[model samples]
Target chain A: MGMARAIEMAKEFGIGMVSIKHSNHFGMSAWLVQQAIDEGMMSLVFTNSSPALPVWGGRSKLMGVSPIACGAPAGDERPFILDMAPSIAARGKIDKAIRQGEKIPTDWALDSEGNMTDNPASALEGVMLPMGGPKGSALSIMMDVFSGVLSGSAYAGHVTNPYDPSKAADVGHFLVAIKPDLFMSLEDFKARMDYLYQRVVSCDKMGGVDRIYYPGEIEQIMRDERMKTGIPFTRGEIDALNEEAKLVGADTLNV
Target chain B: MGMARAIEMAKEFGIGMVSIKHSNHFGMSAWLVQQAIDEGMMSLVFTNSSPALPVWGGRSKLMGVSPIACGAPAGDERPFILDMAPSIAARGKIDKAIRQGEKIPTDWALDSEGNMTDNPASALEGVMLPMGGPKGSALSIMMDVFSGVLSGSAYAGHVTNPYDPSKAADVGHFLVAIKPDLFMSLEDFKARMDYLYQRVVSCDKMGGVDRIYYPGEIEQIMRDERMKTGIPFTRGEIDALNEEAKLVGADTLNV
Candidate 1:
């Protein structure tokens, strides 16, 4: 709802870098970026979540596994959506590994004393590794500052943990939208985009690789497939959704 | 020179996301962002260099190890400058290793056949690994598109290497500046920033670690130290600089 309002506001204005504060979970960052892409505007979206990773060299968890999403419309090709977590691997994946009783890769995180470890439980209690090491760590710091501190939302260790029901979540978002036609004709932009995509795809692939793909190309494929086949949510997730619907006095999912 | 003009134009136009095409090397990205920071604004600076990395799944070298610089002012403490290369390590490190006859790390790059290798020469001829693999590759793509294609500059395989004297180097840059006072009072912003910094530095350190330092904090310490002790450049770097100065008919350095 807020994202729609923000998009409308950005469209009305020549350019908008909207920041939202005191918001709850806003799903995938790419979904929000796609809003602007659909509107013929380029957008970058960012959000700060609960502390899931530690600051670069510090041991205690002082940062979220912050994510950045950048997107723009291409010609006849799928729109470009680049969404990434600054961590080497998202903490959610580590948690999933722990839940499945599987060992995580060693480079994914560090234990309490800061030594690299493959133990999912220890890594969860410690710090998740940043993408590109220090560089990714630095990018995460900036994202938190921009999305949280600058937006007057709870930042750093102050952000609310979703599992902690007593505290209110103060998640923050930083958004930017620019009119595509402002820089160049949207047609020309699209043509150039198509050319770039072709150039990339025409390159020789690494051995054993299926094919080269742009970031959101796979997502587009998935969406098309899902539109016909429907989303295959896990049974547990469906059950949880049904419970939430019952609590809200709404229709429950049959699945 | 182009950066200065872009800064001035951005200031006069209220808010500007300026792009400079056909520009040469403009020094550290932080220096450009600092220009806007000094004017009581936040800035992000990005530039596309020659190809040093490959797209995520493709084997051929097709992308630069692009860099992103983000910065904002703090209260009394040093301004926060987060500058980073979206690669595991810069190509220069590999070049240095090759020159010194040292074996490179296998994780740093892939050989021509796309297999990871510890040989610096083959890695240099091939493609360097991105900071977080796929994510970093995606970032390099966006940075190139934003800084090059959007700016009417050469992009992807079109960018010329600096060492290729026959072709004119055509680098591109993208800069964005925003007023901090837009959302909150500057004083309040500074206060929040201070609180954030304090919270980060106050964390318990990992074993064998000296202390956690913010992105620019160590650079600040080094600057203070070097101001008294003087910068110690490598012999090869000194010779190269002297030769460059001589070629340009500039006065040679005493050292």
Candidate 2:
């Protein structure tokens, strides 16, 4: 539904806009953010799920592999989007590595015994490491609090896995959209953002470094490149997606 | 100066109420945040300085030993404070390690040649590592954009060293304070925050983990413990502080 219409419906419920609770896993955070950006407002979205990582110095899984995405509209360019999981490597990354028969990077994950592992399968059975040790763990905890606790939804460890269709996973998602005119002129903010982007991109490079890319720069570049070259999907991922689509009586993409 | 008075003066300059730029290195990010918190406003502060680390995958130095702090008041309890640097270990931690004749933790620092080192002196001559590699580096870059670029102040390598007395560093600081009432009631936000905090604290503990801690919990505990037991300072640190105090015609603390 259009965000405006959704907001109107939320008003009928006597709440500030609508907050989604127990949402099924969204494909990619950026995709959801783009939906909100299409309406010309700043968007912030968060998701919380089962504990897949431990706090610093602890061996047990205690926090979700939370993710956050923020997007803002620009005048002539694509929206400035930032999407990241609080972990060093998301579980999906590990799965991709496994499919490619590649070794996972060291220290990115730990085995069931809490020992570091490079085998993707072992890493999957283990816990994904937080992005910056304790700091990242703290961020993950905060995301859970904001997305789950504050939203009055399911929290870490209790959340269901979207891949497992047999059981319901009470997933929680929090979203906040602000009209650009709420704080400053949208034109001014866009101009400043553009100028800042240029300055950062034009910065002096360190040794052997050829480019300085901003947060969403590479993704934008990738989208353009993929549009021409076509999206690359592994054989397994293609088969799985196709099978799911077929079950739903939907046509699958040729790619 | 009182925070309210300072903010009023800032407003007189045709800027926001809490404009901060080129402020002398405040003692601690938390201290300055507390000042803003006392004024019944949410606070965000950022500081930039000399190169302490390299970007992920690059061996050469590029960014400063920057830090960011944010604080929001909660009812009845101490404020919610989050203060951290993007580096694996702050420069102050290295200094403390050296004074105590202890080896620095692995991965925290690098020698002059860009190889990892445990010697604090070598680490001092070299560079500190960003936490969790690229994620921390990204955050460091974000700090630059938010604090330096947004405020039209010095960034990264251009920021001066606050410790150096011979040359003025032209260091930059960014402070932002927002009245909660502008967006939501203070009481409502605090109550939500308290609920979030309680849920996280009440979660099941991982093996060998005794208790969970919110962002500012440990610091508050430390402050209380130190108040009763007194802070311990090395003889050399005490001597250096005393000499510096005398040079400024100020009395040294009695320990």
- Look at candidate 2 and give me any clashing residue pairs: A160-A169, B160-B169
- Those runs of model 1 whose alpha carbons end farther than 4 Å from true positions after fitting are A1-14, A91-105, A237-255, B1-14, B92-106, B118-125, B235-255
For A83-158, candidate 2 gives per-residue lDDT tens digits of 7777876678998999999998766787777677889998888778777766777767656655664455666456
> TM-scores of the models, in the given order?
0.89, 0.70
- The docking quality of candidate 2, as DockQ, is 0.18
lDDT of 1 by residue, B85-134 (tens): 77888778999998999998676888888878899999877788877778
lDDT of each: 0.78, 0.65
Model 2 quality (TM-score): 0.70
Among all candidates shown, the one with the greatest lDDT? 1
Candidate 2: tens digits of C-alpha lDDT, residues B29-82: 888768766766555566665665676555666666577676666666556677
Ten-residue stretch with the least lDDT total in model 2 chain A: A9-18
CAPRI class assigned to model 1: medium
